[model samples]
Target: MAQTTAVSSTHRLWIGAQAWALRRLSAFSRAPRTAPHLETGTRGEREALFHLRRLGYTIVAHRWRTPKLRGDVDLVAGHGHTLCIVEVKTRTRRDAVPAELAVDPDKQRILRRLARAYLHRLPPRAREAPVRFDVISIYLESSPTSTPAPSIQLNIELNQGAFGWA
Candidate 1:
């Protein structure tokens, strides 16, 4: 009986070690890949935030999403009496499509719907404010390699009122 008890204890220890190793392996596999394209997009969003601040726009939310909503508003800001819903686009020089051209009519329609949903969640003071959609396009220089530390040049363009609520 004592031998059987010892064997059972050893079995439990082995199973625990296996589970711990599996969890570690899964976490390592799920680590985010620092791909250049993704990095460029993140950098563009940061640039847009800085630009908006410099222009005296008060940012109310970043990447705001509602539980029941299908889409998210990248940046919700206010400048004086108008509230702005911003969409950010990032592209490298090697990309065939221009950033501005990427936001087609369908995309605009989706953004407008998202903005409406966002407004519904705001207080009456903000809900009644006039709203507009803006697009920020960032063009980056093509890098020679996919190295994570490559230096790149960025040209940012702000298109205010790119689309309207109506």
Candidate 2:
């Protein structure tokens, strides 16, 4: 049990390290702010991506930044049959507002626009491939453990094969 706890702690720290590296790279590229919320979002995205992989998704791209949209797709993935363009939104808790509600209709529209642009960039065959838009919400309901407080659970929901668009 002690070993298991140690391993879990190590894994969390490693995840933090990975986020730190990404933040550093983005900084070097002269990107915008790397606030704690950004780190939290990135971390949540990574966790969501891992869950998708475990459930049989092949990640093709990540953090695909664009100028016109000025946004990012947390993960571009495929699940054997259809290409999945995923939007990840992370929240620390589910208080009056839930995590899934963060991706508003306007945000979905932006995602659709970017998804079309992404499809246009592919070859004809690839462009014609079946595609889907999905939203993965990562709800982290725990406080930082530099100190101890209450326990928080993580919830990852994949709105798989989300068919409609704005």
Candidate 3:
């Protein structure tokens, strides 16, 4: 039993190391962010990581992409037996249309393709696990205060099974 536990712990550590390396490689390849929206998105993804962990989700990847694919998945997580392909949308303010609505039919199609690519790269066991599409909307609002530099408050919403493979 002790041997089994040690092997499990080592396996988990290896997976964590691989995920960290992937994130670092992605950051090195991506250009610097200057736009306000881009900055907001970066912050949103960071916040989303914490939010998902609080919900008992194990993050598998961040900014996952395939060389042949044109787009990237904002986050990939696992909850129970389900594999979650997460898309994150961030805005300075909530618009008339909900942020989740942005994952329209067109966007859903793209995500589906990306998910397929991601699954192909996974090991046989995980590749066959159930897959789910999730969307996380983050709205950043400035808190009303007397201070010159008002703090930003984040409103995060997680929509599990946001879309279907069909």
* TM-scores of all predicted structures: 0.71, 0.72, 0.79
- Which candidate ranks first by TM-score, i.e. highest? 3
Residue range 1-166, candidate 2, lDDT tens digits = 0001123545556655765676457546755658989778877887787666656677899988678775777799987767889988888877687666677877777778888888878889898777788888888888567656665578887777553564
How many residue pairs clash in each candidate at the backbone level? 0, 0, 0
Name the candidate, 2 or 3, with the larger lDDT value.
Answer: 3
Per-residue lDDT of model 3, residues 41-129, tens digit only: 88788768766765667888999999998889999998877888999998888889999999999999999999999999888887889
Question: Which candidate model has the greater TM-score, 1 or 3?
Answer: 3
Off by over 4 Å in 1: 1-31, 94-97, 142-150
Instruction: Looking at model 3, report the run of 10 residues with the lowest lDDT sum.
Output: 1-10
How much lDDT does candidate 2 score? 0.74
* Candidate 1 lDDT tens digits, 48-83: 765666566778898888877576778898876788
Candidate 2: TM-score?
0.72
Better of 1 and 3 by lDDT: 3
Pairing residues by index, what is the TM-score of model 1?
A: 0.71
